[model samples]
Target: MRQMRERLGTPRAAGVAGVLFALLMAAAIILVRLALPGGADGTEITVDAGQRGAVQTALELLPFAGISFLWFMGALREQAGAGEDRFVSTVFLGSGLVFVAMLFGCGAAAGTVLDDGQPPSAFGRHYAYTLLTTYGLRMAAVFVFTASTIGRRLGVWPRPLILLGYAVGLVLLVVGADMPWSELVFPGWALIVSLHILKGHRPTDHPSPTTP
Candidate 1:
């Protein structure tokens, strides 16, 4: 922890990671929404418009997986540092990547299910919907918890953004009430963090007493 405090005393990388992760998170959400049923797929427009609500709900719920994965990368970078250890860090990175990838895959799969030009079996459609929504929410929780804990230990703490993120995530989980929006809040939080990353942190030449 002391080592990281000394390394991150400048705060540049933390800000940079925050901004970059936020952009990527936003992009992931946009991409998933574009590919979903009510999105570019036009399934909802041509067929049952009521299903558009479901599709929109699914779209909102789905992208958190990718956002979570990208945020995890920032957290991982903070831990591993800009050193030779990055190769080792990647091994740990795979889990989050896979989670996000699966969400994307599920989005594509959902689009196909909706576009089949017929009413799907209640069982199969429900199953796919469940899978898509479940993973997104799970991964979002993982990212927030991971960020709050890991960021603190790394001495960067993500400042105001992370605390607000945790609160928003908690409210979404409670008020969302099994709806997929419970997961959507995290992507916006991830987006904020990513933007902070791009802006880069302002560096201070001298370290504080706590920085070892």
Candidate 2:
């Protein structure tokens, strides 16, 4: 029974973690996007008091979001069980780790701008933005691709969800750098996957038999 509980609990825990990761990541991204200037060139990054506060809040949330993402990844792998394909799992784990690292790197770069007590240099601002929206999200795209592949192979995710995952991955890969809000797709995908897992685990009620 102890082992049974552990077996049953792990996936649920992962689902919860995935949900948390999605929420936190989305919040952080939204806050940062709101705080930053709209231009792509990053030459005019003047932060007002409100923007400063928003950016600081986003930075504070990012580390916790990264941690939760790691938990989500682990739980997902565990859900894959022992028969998971080594190549796909390797790619999944590697991409996930790289994505988190890049996320923290972006946060650190942004924090440095905040710490400098002056407007960020255009180069620094562009560097951080590129790290996040370009390279980091591309890693996330790889993660999505590999994860969806594994899910499809294992019959874990439904066809529609798998197709959506593929679409999200493609967006991240091809259009994320050019698109302003494409980063949200990652957390959105995570939310969908998490909710699906939770829904799947819900206990079903049986109808009573009629008397003869």
Candidate 3:
């Protein structure tokens, strides 16, 4: 059992957590997007049975997603070892917590609308949307930026993956609220990073020696 526990405590465990988090979060986002109408005019919206069901399903999945995300964060920190920079690590951890909090907040707000069996008041709906698309995604952007930076510095990630992270972060930071389905970038990047980590290919740590 001890050996099993030790084995599960490796960076590969973090990669697994990252993969789970990515899938759960992507599902939640897709369900929510399908359930809710687009455009900022919340007052004009109405909720049907299908939409309610979708939102409920999304809310149910969110808590699990958040928990997995926390595990992923811890695993990532463990993988960073003692060489992690304090400032960037702080940003990474802080943004991840804030993102999860905002995600829960959005879920709670949507739950309230469901409980009432009607569309939320325009203010309420807009508030929830803003929390998710604006605050939550911005925090996610920060998390991605910091994670990518740490990965690059540690030589844990390929240059192409790091570049893709930058692009995803920019989208979340600048236009996440304006763009439909932009939140998908977060999970997409997470999936790629997790897969790479799982492959156990840290270039800096395992450089090929020159054949003299």
30-61 in candidate 2: lDDT tens per residue? Answer: 98887785734755567777887888999999
lDDT by residue for model 3 over 77-191, one digit each (tens)?
Answer: 7766655789999999999999999999988876755755565556667777889998999999999999989888866778998899899999999998889888888988888
> How close to the true structure is residue 208 of candidate 1, measured as C-alpha lDDT?
45
Q: How much lDDT does each candidate structure score?
A: 0.51, 0.83, 0.82
Ranking by lDDT: 2, 3, 1
Question: For residue 181, what is the lDDT in candidate 3?
Answer: 84
Candidate 2 local lDDT, residue 61 = 95
lDDT of 3: 0.82
What TM-score do all the candidates reach, one by one?
0.56, 0.88, 0.88
| TM-score of candidate 3 on Cα atoms, chains taken together | 0.88
lDDT of 1 at 133: 56
- On lDDT, the leading prediction is 2
